[model samples]
Target: MIYKVLASILLLLVIIGGWSWTEYQSARNTLAVPGEQVSIDIKKGDSFDNITHKLIAQNVNIKPFWFKVVAMQEKATTKIKIGEYVLKGGMTAPELLAVLVSGKQKQYSITFPEGWAFKEILQEIAKNSYIEHTLTDSTIDFSALMAKLKVEKNHPEGLFFPDTYFFEKNTTDIAILKRAYDKMQVVLNEEWGKKEANLPLKSPYEALILASIVEKETGAKVERPLIAGVFTRRLEIGMLLQTDPTVIYGMGDNYQGNITLKDLRTPTTYNTYTIKGLPPTPIALPGRDAIVATLHPAAGDSLYFVARGDGSGTHVFSASLKDHNAAVNTHQRKAN
Candidate 1:
């Protein structure tokens, strides 16, 4: 009877060893087709069981028992991060556990293009469903927002650097705004230190205001310095900027698709035709090139420009109003 009991015990040990080896191999095998990918969200306070269920629901061919065993072996059960994670098809159970423990969450992007206004930036932020919206309204309280960002300027316009910003899911809008704002400050200060001497700008803020105008004036990268030169010369000579964009900005909600003679004659803080110097604040978010162009305006005698109106988006530069009017007559008449 003792000999028979010993043989049965040996048989049970062999079976258990075989099962353990099988599970170990399974833990190392791919969980899905080689090139397949899946996304899963692990919320805060989620249990290890909950994560296993989530994986299974996403069609990942993972054996929960083996997965848990591997997690225990790696000591990753208490270390998995909470965020959106992308799992690859060829990833083994151990590899997935490593990724979760690393906290390398999926990144999403939001872009603020050059020449966009503050209102447009706010609207874009509001439209992003992945971001955590913390602001009270689309028309943000500028002073309060600036305080939150720790920015000295009360106006938010032209403060944010226009570029593609990346963040993990559920990042706050204010967090993104602060990043952009800080980036702009760094870039502006750097450029200001390198700016050419004798420019009309008194401070980096003035450069920003002029840069915003240059950005709104043209989309052509090559024309930016030329446009800056015109504005700078005007500022030096006490000539009216007469920029239509400022007039339109002043018109605000009242501005239609086009500006009128009445609009130019009417006075507002932003209307360059009526105002003597730069606007009370920046009118739009200028790109790096615009800021650079404003600081280092091209050397030229030309003081005025009109669109070529040939759909090339180029302009005609002139030194005298007579010549500018002639070009305007030629181009504007042709366009009409």
Candidate 2:
């Protein structure tokens, strides 16, 4: 009778050990088919049970009992962060738990291209569905918005850097704007310290104003320094900038894709054609290259430039009005 009892006890111990080994092996195996991907969102106040159910709902092939055991063993049962996470097919239970505790959420990106205006930046931000929209009105008061961003400047134009920014889901528009603004500040200051001597710009802001003009002037990469040279010389000689982009900006919504003589004659704060000096603020967001070109203008005697008008965006530079007129006539005649 004692031998039978002992045999039964040994059999029970063996069954328990086998079951434990199976569960441990399951924990180490992949939860989903190889190469499959799943996205899961863990919300605030979500319990471990809730997370398990969500994984199952997404066909993650996770066994709740073994998953909990693994989580307990890793001491990550309460460490899962609340955000969107991507689970790959080949991830084991331990690997998934590590990701949950790592707090490295999936990221989304938004890009602000070079030469974009403040309004254009606002429009692009509005189009992103993942970003949380705090400023509903595109025409919100600039002063209040700048204040909210902790920026001392009254105008927000040219303050934010033009670059691709990544953020987690539901990041606020203001938060991204602040990041861009801070980046621009750091970059502008660093570049300003290394600027060329004898520049007519009195402040970093003036360089920004000129840089914005350079950005809007041409799409040709090589022409930026040349354009900056012409503008800088014009400033040095007390000549009217007479640039068409400034006129278009001054005209605001009145511009119709073409600049007329009368439009150039009309004066506004931004109209370099009539204004004696740099505009009150930047007309658009200038990239780092534009800023650099403006600060370190190419050494040249050319005071005038016009588009070549032969399908190439290259411009013909002239040192005298006569040569400029000839180039303009030649290009205009071809265009006509």
Candidate 3:
């Protein structure tokens, strides 16, 4: 009877040991190592076996048969999303499963500087890795993209807000540009809400148009409000804006050298000399400060400005036509 009892006890121990080994193998196959960035792409309706092979090929360190079992246990078939994912090592089966199911990729940031035109911004995105397009498609006409965004004008000038934006890696250029347009809309709405009373601007769009002019006129931060004040004052007094930047923008790529008196009188919609009030659209993407400056300009009655040629970048302001003409001849028109 004692010998029989010993045999039964040995059999029970063997069963318990086998059970523990099975659990150990299950856990080992499901868990991953730490600090590794593993990328896996799961296609639509892909079977667990096929996905397992892909992970193994990518050095995921998980066995196919055991992974299927774990996936089944976790009910991951319907939960997995189709996209690229970064799975780290030392992650549990649940954690990796969650990543794949979420279908979220890493987000990257692109910064658009103040005063950049739409074409310039497009070129920047084409060269960015986070933004993708076929090499041939990179030069796609912007008019259609602008149309898709529903911008009123044929050109997308001043529609894209100059700011840093976050996007998924390999994001399309149009996608980033759409975000830029949305950003502009948001910012303009906010600024319009807090606008100062009695300004010459008729609407938020007009304010943006004015801000674009300010952006191209100068890079001086403190001077933005002053510059805005000068233009606003001119508009109120029924005087022509006569800004040089407008002339440059009108010239486009064909601008040779210095703008002559003839260019000032040229009949272009962008020419402040020819047009009344603000230009038909924005000349460039203005920064926040420029927008704010348009809403709340510096208190001044100065009507004219000329670059001092001191290279210090500060312009000399004048209230009289006589002073302005003298400064222009002294600083810019004379032979250097």
TM-score per candidate, in order? 0.96, 0.96, 0.82
The lDDT of each candidate is 0.91, 0.90, 0.81
Write candidate 1's Cα lDDT for 1-336 as tens digits.
Answer: 999999999999999999998878877675642457888899998999999999889888778888888889899989999999988778888888888899999899999999999989998999999999999585578899999899899989889999999999999999999999989999999999999999989999999999999999999999999999999999999888889888888899999799888889999999998889899888899999999999989999999999999998889999999999999999989898
If both were scored by TM-score, which would come out higher, candidate 1 or candidate 3? Answer: 1
Q: Determine which window of 10 residues in candidate 1 has minimal summed lDDT.
A: 27-36
- Model 3 vs truth, CA RMSD: 3.9
Q: Clashing pairs in model 1?
A: none
What residue runs in model 1 are displaced by over 4 Å at the alpha carbon?
Answer: 32-35
lDDT of 3 at 317: 90
* Predicted candidate 2 versus true structure: per-residue lDDT over 57-157, tens digit per residue: 98777788888888898999999999998877788888888888998988999999998889899999999999999987755899999999998889998
Instruction: Give one digit per residue, the lDDT tens place, for model 3 in 188-298.
Output: 989989988999899999999999999988889999999999999999988999898888888898678789889998879889999888888898999888999999899
Task: Count steric clashes of candidate 3.
Answer: 5
Error in Å for residue 207 of model 2: 0.8
Error of 2 at 122 (Å): 0.6
